[model samples]
Target chain A: MKRRTRKAFISLIIAIAAFAILAIELYPIAITVINGFRRDIVILSGQPFKLSQLTLRSYQMVLKNIGFQLGMKNSIIIGLLSTGISVLIGAMASYGIARFRFSWRNGLAYSFLVFRMLPQISLVIALYLMFSYVGIRDTIGGITLAHTSFNVPYVIWLLLPFFTAVDKAYEEAAMVDGCNRYGVFFRIFLPIVAPGLVVAAVFAFLNSWNEFLYALILTGVNAKTAPIAINGLLGGETLTWGQACAAGTLMLVPVFFFTLGMQKFLIRGITAGGVKG
Target chain B: MSSRKPDTDGVSVSLIKGKARHRAPFLFLLPALLVVFAVLIFPIVFSFFVSGFNWPLSEGAGTRKFVGLGNYLALSVDPEFWNSLKLQLGFIFIAIPIELLFGFAAALLLNREFFGARLVRSLLLLPVFFLPILSGMTWRFMLQPRYGPLNALLLKLGAPEITWLGRPVTAYAAIIVQDIWRMWPFMFMLLYAGLTSIPQELNEAAEIDGAGFWLKLRSITIPMLTPTIMTAVLLRIIDALRVFSEVYVMTEGGPGSSTTLFSLYTHRQAFGYQKVGMASAMAIFLLCISIAFALTLVRKNMSLDSLEEKAGGG
Candidate 1:
């Protein structure tokens, strides 16, 4: 009976802890969404947790801002372009590293890992100067290129194991049947690794979309991304909580859903990177 | 084996084999190597070159003058730079252990079969997906002294309303808390991965031997989790050292420079003060620190692998 009571007490503790974890995780998101719908800043300030009358004024205000619209456009373009280019290049490189045994293969692979792990700040200044000199500093193309540089290595790393896991017999048979190396890669290998490519593309898109430092330093008025624009709202003299929260909610929408849909692959990807590195 | 290969095809086969062996790998690697070189390697080399000069953005690159070792020497005595380094160390040392502890506890709790486990795990990962800037801004608003929900809760509990982000201590604490909240989920996921990967037989055997929960955890669980723990710790330390967006959006390294992280300081020097050379030097210093940590991690990982092999084999 004593042991049963002890077991019951422990289970109770675990349940309570689990509930608290849920509350803590959901609180900020709930508050952000709630505050976005609120119109009166005074009420928001006074009773942040209280439910007030919901309205679309904040969203309307944010959507009406030209900078927010431009930022959204630039963010989407950069994210898509970078993810596409990074996945294409990363796939080829990972195929080479996985299938071909070259003298410098291990060295090249390690270097890519090191590059991926390096902090962006260490390299941003040089990139800024180089881009400026080349006359693409504030352009959408420039930011996309910068994002690709950081992301391709990550994509390559993530895709390498996936490619290595694929059977070589498929490629060998395709090659034996009069297909060239490129054709085999495009026809058989690419289709085989499509799931990994999807995961890589999703991660690359999210990384580029959420990047702030490069966008802040590399771009001016021309190609400011959503994070930077949202940050600008916060930096304004007046605290427009409703509008800011609305923008925040908008920025989070794609990523929140993407994460939920691809939770399995994302978890596996993260663990693979951590464990293998 | 029934059909012998044609001897006349030897020339064509050798030629094709030679071409494939010699060129395919390089061809495959060319595009990625070019991008990495242009965007990553070139910048690193250029940063090193520019670190020796007294360069400013206002002054064109042609007008820059060389100052050999000047920026490095200047940093040796710069109190602000030193303080930022200290703060980064403090942030990593304090926040990482707490994250690991809390994450481990959470992982342990959720490792058991339970109702809504999938839902809870997914919910826990939400913070990891939030944009760092947005997370920082939301936390900044929520920590407001007068109107923030936290202070409001405190007021209801009969405690005095404390200015959360206005004071140095509280401001630093707020940054740490924000970081812990944003990052503990990552550690939890990784540790939970580690926990789930452990062979159940070891724990079962321990249980058969009359081992209690604590004994099983210490003897069977933690030893097996060392590799995952090391990887998680290394990644977190490297990440924490380079923290910027959260601190930038929340504190801007304020409360009298109490929360100036290394990256934020480099940014201020380069952009705010327009001291490009000085900032480059700081960036190099940050690079050296990262390299040292990474090397230590590699060496430790090697040793740990050998140790684990022995433990398992014996």
Candidate 2:
């Protein structure tokens, strides 16, 4: 009976702690969403948690902003293009490393790992100089190229295990049945590893979409992404808290829903990183 | 099964197979290698070359003059560089353990079967998906001394309204809080995965031996989770060292240079002060640190693999 009571007390504490964590995690997001709908910044100042006179004025203003729209377009283009290129090339390389034994295969695999671990800021300066010299500095294509540089290695790392785990017997049987290597990869191997591809693509898209440093350095106006656009709202003469919050919501909502839908895959992808090769 | 087993036919077939085998891998790797070379490898080499020169963004590459080791030498004596390095180290040391503690606790609590476990787990990961700049902006607004919700809560509780981002220490604390809030979920997710991956038999065996929760956690759970913990810590440290956007958005590395992290400092040197050579030197310095950490991680991974093999064998 004493032990049962002690267990109950401990459980209560755990429950409280979990509740606190939830509040801490969700509070700022809640405030952001609420402030986005609020028309009066003064009311936010007075009563942040109060629900009074909410409107879509801030959202209307942010959505109509040309810079915001351009940023959205650029972000989508960069995200999708970079993700596609990264997954395609990375899957090929991962397949090579997984299927073919070569003298430098281990070295190539580790190099990809190292590249994936590299800090973006470390490479941003040189990339800026190089891209400008090549006359692609402020273009969306240039930013996509930069994003793919990191994402490809990431994709390779994530997909290597997936490809390695695939049964070689299937590929061999296909080849023996008169299917060429390319045909086997497309028709059999690719279909088998579709889940890994989806996970890699999702990560690549999110990473590119959320990336700021490369986008900030490489693009000036024409190719600025959404994160940069939202950051721009934080600066300058006026502090448009309402509009900025609205913009933040716009930037966050899609990713949030996407993440919610892909939570299972995301969890697996994350845990897969911890798995020993 | 065939005449191919004879010497002449077997030799020719083996040679063709060998050639094809060698060529196939390279064919598969070509596109990725080309992209890596053009984007990552070439830029690194270019950066190293540029770092050797006193290059300025304002000046064209042609007009720039070489100043070999001048920037590195300057960086060695630069107080701001040292300060930034110190800040980075401090941030890592302080933030990582706290994150681990919070994450471990959360993981422990959530590892149990619960009604809202799935919903809570998904909600916990929300911060990980938040755009850093937006999160920073939200926190920046929320941490305001007068109008911020936090201070408002303090006032309601009859506590003095302390300036959250007004001073150096509090400002730095705010940065740490923002980062921890954004990142603790990652650590939690990884640790939770690690916790869940431990076989139930081990814990049951420990319980059968009259072990309590703490004993089981210490002897069985932690030992099993070491690799995951190490991976999580290394990744977090590398990430913590490169923290830029949060600082850029939150404090802008100041009431002074109090919170000037390495990446933010590099940004200031490169863009704010137009010291490309100096900034490139700093970037290389950071790259060196990352490489060192990567090497350590590789070494740890190897040792852990051996340990696992030994455990499995035994």
Best by lDDT: 1
- Clashes by residue pair, model 2: none
Docking tier of model 2: it is: acceptable
Local distance difference test scores for all models:
0.82, 0.81
Candidate 1 pairs with clashing backbones: none
Model 1: residues with Cα > 4 Å off, grouped in runs = A1-13, B1-20, B60-63, B295-314
Per-model TM-score, in order, reads: 0.92, 0.91
Candidate 2 per-residue lDDT over residues B189-296, each given as its tens digit: 988988988999999988999999899989998999888999889878877877888788888899789888999999988888788888888888899899788767
Candidate 1 C-alpha lDDT tens digits along A108-191 = 765665677778899899999999999999999999999999898888877865676676668777777888889988998899
Residue-level lDDT of model 1, residues B83-147, one tens digit each, is: 88888888999999999998898898899865567788878988878888988888898898878
lDDT of 2 by residue, A1-277 (tens): 9998997787667666676778879998888888888875664565777887789999899899899899989999989999999999989888876666555755677677678778888899999988888999989899999999988888887786677667566877777787876787789999999988988998888889889889889999999998888888888768788888898888787788779988777754543333454
TM-score of chain A of each: 0.94, 0.93
